[model samples]
Target: MPDYKKNSISLTGAVGLGTGVMISAGIFALLGQVAELSGSWFPLIFIIGSIVTAFSAYSYVKMSQEYPSAGGIGMFLVKAYGKGTITASAALMMAVSMIINQSLVARTFGTYTLQLFDGAQTEWLVPLLGVGLIVVSFLINISGNTFIQTFTSIASLIKIIGLSTMAIAGIIVADFAFTIPNKASNPPDIGIVSSVAAIALTILAFKGFTTITNSGEEITKPKKNVGRAITISILVSLSVYLLLAWAVSSNLTLSEIIAAKDYALAEAARPAFGDFGVWFTVILAIIATITGIIASVFAVSRMLAMLTEMKLIPHKHFHMPGSIQKHTLVYTVVLAIVLTVSFDLTRIASIGAILYLVMDIMIHWGVFRHLRKKVNANPFIVVSAIVLDLIVLSAFLWVKFQSDIVVVVVAILMITFIFIGEYAFLRKTSD
Candidate 1:
C-alpha cells in the first residue's frame, strides 16, 4: 500500500481543488444550455441552484467532519449502508458522474480552443483535442501530490481572476442592461418547470465542490478544514457563476447564446472586446478545463482506489501498475476518454446531472435515515436537500424526455446497469 499522504493538502489547496473543478468548463459550457431551458432569466437559475447545493453540501460537510477519510463519499456511503449494494452502486455512480464531468470539460476545452480557428472541422478536431487533454492530465496526476496541489492552485487563481475580469468588463460594456436583441426570435417565457429543470445544470455546475470532500483526509485539518473548504468553495463558485451568467446574458441574445452554446463565453466576448476578447476567453477556458481535469482525476482515482481496498468493487492491474491509485488513475482516464469520444456535450451534461442528483439523493437519505444523529446533522436541512434534488431531478428528466428521450433512456440504463452489476458482484463476493 502507498502512503495516503495525510496532511499534505492545505486548506487553500483544498479550495483550489474544489473550485478548480467547480469553475472549470461548467460556466463555459453549461451556461447556454441552461439559458436554452430557462430563457432570459438563466442567471436566477444559478442562484436557486446554489441554494439547493448548499442544502446538499450539508450532508457531506457533516459526514466529513465526523468521519474524514481518503475514501470520501465512498466512506460515507459504507458507514450509512454498510458494505452492501446500495453503498457500492451509489459510490460508483458518483465516481462515474465525476468522470463524465471530466469528459464534458475536456470537450469544452476543445470547443473553446477551436474558436481561435475559423472553419475547424469539429467532427474530428473536438474529440481529438479532448483526448489529448485527458492524456496530459493523466501524466500530471502521476507526478504526485505536491505538484498537483501547486498547479491546480495556480490555475484556479488564474481562471478566477480572468473570468471575473471578463464578466465585469462584459457587464460594463452592456451598460448593466440585459435584453434579448432579437425580439422577433425572443426566447419563450420561463415557466416553473423550465426553471426547475435548468437548476439541474446549475447544480451540475456547482457539483465540483464535492472534490473537496473527496480529498478530506489529505487536507491539513480533516475535520475542520474539510467543511470550511466545502463552504468557501461553494460561495466562491456562486459569486463567479452569477457574474458569468449575467455577463454572458448581457452580451448575447438568447438566440446567439443558444447557437454558440458550447462556446458561449467566447461568443459573449466578441461584442464586448472583439477578437482580443475571444482570445482571452479561450485562454481562460483552456486553463480552467486543464486544472479541472487534474483536480477531478486526482480525487476520483483516489475514491475508486478506496473502493477497491474496501472490496466494494473489483480491480485488475493487468500487468501494469505502481499502486492501486496508479491503476485506478489509468482506469479513470480511459473511461473519460471513451465518453469524450462517444458523446456530445449536451448528452454528457445531461447524463452527469442525472447520475449526480440520484447519488446526491442517496447521500442525503443515508445521512437523514441512518447517520443524521451520529453526525449531528439537521433533519430539516437533510430533508430539504432530498426534496430539492427530487424536484430538480424530476423536472430535468421530464424536460429531457420531451426534448431528447435518448438522454433519459441512457441515464436510466446506466443507473440500472450500475445497481444490477454491483449487486451481482457483492453477492458473489459474499458467497
Candidate 2:
C-alpha cells in the first residue's frame, strides 16, 4: 500500500469546502416553494431555519471539539450510544440520506442546465447529465484530497461572487423594477404550521455544514477549526440566503414567483437584469450544483470509508488496488447513480429531508441522554434542538402526506429497511 500523505487544508479552505458542499441548487429551486409557504415573509423564515439549525449544531460542535475524528457523526454516535444497534442504525440513516441528497443535487444540476434551452425538458436528460457529473466528481475525488480542496476553493470563490452580484443587483433594481408595493400585491396569512413546514426545506439548504465535520481530520487545527468552519459556513450561507430571498420577494410578485417555481432565481434574474441576469443566474446555478456535487461526494465517500473501518458496513475490494477511500468513492458514485436514475427531484428531496431530520433527532437525543454531561454541552440547547427537529419534521411530513403520499411512504419504508438490515448484519458479525 502506498503511504497516503496528510491533507493540509487551511481554515479558509475548510470554510470553502463547507460552503461549496452546501450552496447548491436546492436554494435555486426551493426558494419559490418556500415562498409559497412563508409567502412574503420567506426572508424571516430563512432566519428561523438558521436559528433551528444552530440549535442542532450546538451538539455537533461540542462533541466534535471534544472528539475530533474523520469518523464524523459516526464517531459521535458510537461515543453516545456505545456501538449498539442504535448507533449503527442512526449512522446508516444519515449516510443513506446523504446519498439521497447527492441524487437530489445531481438532478437539480440537470434541471437548472436544461433551463438554458427550449424544449430541454426530456425525462432521460436529467438523470443522464446527473450520472455524468457524478462520474466526473468520482475521478476528481480519487485524485486525492489536495486536488479536491484546490478545485473546491476555486469553485467556491466563483459561486460566492456570482451570487453576491446577483443579490446586490436585484436589491438595487427592486426600487425601479416595480413601483407597486409587494406587501399590497400579496398578503400571506401563513399560520404556525405552514411556517414550520417551510423551515424543513430551508434546513436542507443548511445541511451542507455537516459536510465540514467529515473533513475534521484533514483540517488544520482540527479542534478549533472544525467548529469554526461549521459556524462560519452557516453564517455565510444564511446571509446569502436571506439576501437572495429578499431580492426575489422584492422584485417578483407572489403569482410570478409561484409560476416560475421550478426555476425561480433564473426567472427573478430576468426582471432584475434582463436577459443577461437570466444567463448569469443560470450559469451560477450550474456552478453551484457542480461544486456542490463534488464537495458532497468527497465528504460522503470519506464517511463510508470510516464506516468500513469500523466494520459497520460490508465492503469489497473489487480487484481494485487502492486505499479504502478510493474504493468507497467508487461505491458512493455507483449508489448515487442508482438513485439519480430511479427517483424524480421532488421525491428525492422528500426522502433526503425526512431521513436527515430523523437522524438529526436521534443525534440530539443521544447527546441529551448520554453525552451531554460528559461533553459539558448545555442540556437546554440539546433539548431545544430535539424539539425544533420534531416540530419541523412533523410539519414537513404533514405537508408531504397531503401532497405526495407516495414519497412519504417510500421514506418510511427506506428507514425501516435500513434499521432492520443493520441490526441483522451486526448480529451476524457478533455470532
Candidate 3:
C-alpha cells in the first residue's frame, strides 16, 4: 500500500524507453569488443548471454511484482530478505554504478557527436559535449517527472528511427557469412583472453533491464507490465545485438571491423549506403546518447532515494523533495563530474558491469532460494546461470586485471564505500 501513483508505464512506453536506453550502450559500442573476445565464438557467446539475460529478465520481473517499489535491487534485497541495511547500502552502490555506466555511455555518445562537428577534437570534444549534455539533462530532470518522461519518450523515438534505419539497411545489404569465423580456433592464444575481456565489456549492452526495476514504483501494472517491460525490452535489444554482430561480422573482416569499429555502424552502413551511412549513425548515436543520459540520471537518483527511505543514508543528503524532481540535479551533477573528467568508457563500464553482475547474482540467488522453500525448480538451471554469470564476470576481471590501474581504483573506491556504508552506517542505524 504505497501512496505512489498506480498509473504504471504502459507496455509501449516501457518497451520504447527500454530499447532506447539499451541500444546506445550495446550496439553503438560493444560489438568490436565482443568480436575480439568471442574469437570464432563471438556470436555463440552473445546468443548464450542473451538467453541468460532473457531469463535474468524473468527473474527480476518476479522480484518486481513481489516488491513493487522504486528501489529496484535495493527493494529486492531488503524486502525479500529483511536485510534492510545490506540492501540499502547495495542501493547506494547501484546508484553510483548507474552514474558510472550512464555517464560513460553518454560520453561515448559525446564522442560520436563530436564527429558531427568539423574541426573538433573528437576525443576531448566528445567528453566536453557529454559534460554539457549532463548539465542540460540535470535541468530537465529537476524540472519534473513529466518533463523527464516526455523527453525520454522523444529520445527513444529518435533512437528507434536511427537504429531501425541501420538494421534495415544492414539486412538488405550486408552478408553474415563473411564475418562468422568459418574455422574453429585450433589454439587461440592470448586471443582467448581478449575474447573473454570482450564479454565483460559487451555485457553492458544487456544491462538496461535493471533500470526498469528502478522505476518499478511508477509502473502502471507492477506484476504484469514490469515483467513484460524487462523481458521484452532486453529481448528487443539482444535481437539487435545479434543482428549487428551478424551485420558487422558478416560484412567486414575482423581486422576491418576493428579498424573501422568505433564507427562500425557507419562502416556497416557504407556498404549498404555510402556516405549516407556516416550521417545516419552519427544521428542515431546522438539521439541515443541524449536519451540515455536523461533516463540513466533520473533512474539512479531515484535509486539513491531508496537508501534514504530505509534510513541507510540520512534523508537530507539525498531526498526527493517532490516527485523525484529534487534529486535529478544531484544525479546529473555527479554524471557531469564523471564525464568531464574522462571518457574512459572501458574502465567506467567495467566497474559498472562488475557491480551490476554482483547485484544480479545476489538477487538471482536470493530469489531462487526463496522459491525453493515453497516449490521445486531446476538446480541445474540456477547452477548454470550462476556459472555463466561467473564466466562472464571472470572474463571481465581477467582483462581488467592486466590493462588499467584506474579502472581497478575506481571499482575499489565504489566497493569500499558499499562495505563501509553497510557495516559502519547501516549497522549503526539498525542498532
lDDT of each: 0.93, 0.83, 0.67
Query: Roughly what TM-score does model 3 have, to 2 decimal places?
Result: 0.87
Question: How do the residues 161-251 of candidate 2 rate in per-residue lDDT, one tens digit apiece?
Answer: 8898889889888762433325554535556677788898888888888888877777788889889999999998888887788788777
Alpha-carbon TM-score of each model against the true structure: 0.98, 0.94, 0.87
Clashes of each: 0, 0, 6
Q: What is the clash count of model 1?
A: 0
lDDT of 3 by residue, 1-431 (tens): 24234564556666655776687756776665566555655766677667767656656676677676776777777754665655665666667666876777666776676656557364666667767877777777666555666777777766766676577567667542444634442224436656656666656777777778877888778777888888787777777777667766666666666555455666766677776776877888877777776777767777766656566665443534554325544754775566556646555677778877776676667667665333244446656666667887777776777776666667777787777767787667767
Candidate 1 lDDT tens digits, 23-54: 98789999989988888678888999999999
Candidate 2: C-alpha lDDT:
0.83
For model 3, the superposed segments whose C-alpha errors exceed 4 Å read 1-4, 83-85, 118-122, 175-178, 181-193, 315-325, 370-380, 428-431
The lDDT of model 3 is: 0.67
After superposition on all CA atoms, what RMSD does each candidate show versus the true structure? 1.2, 2.3, 3.3
- Itemize residue pairs with steric clashes in candidate 3: 8-219, 8-220, 9-220, 37-195, 179-249, 179-250
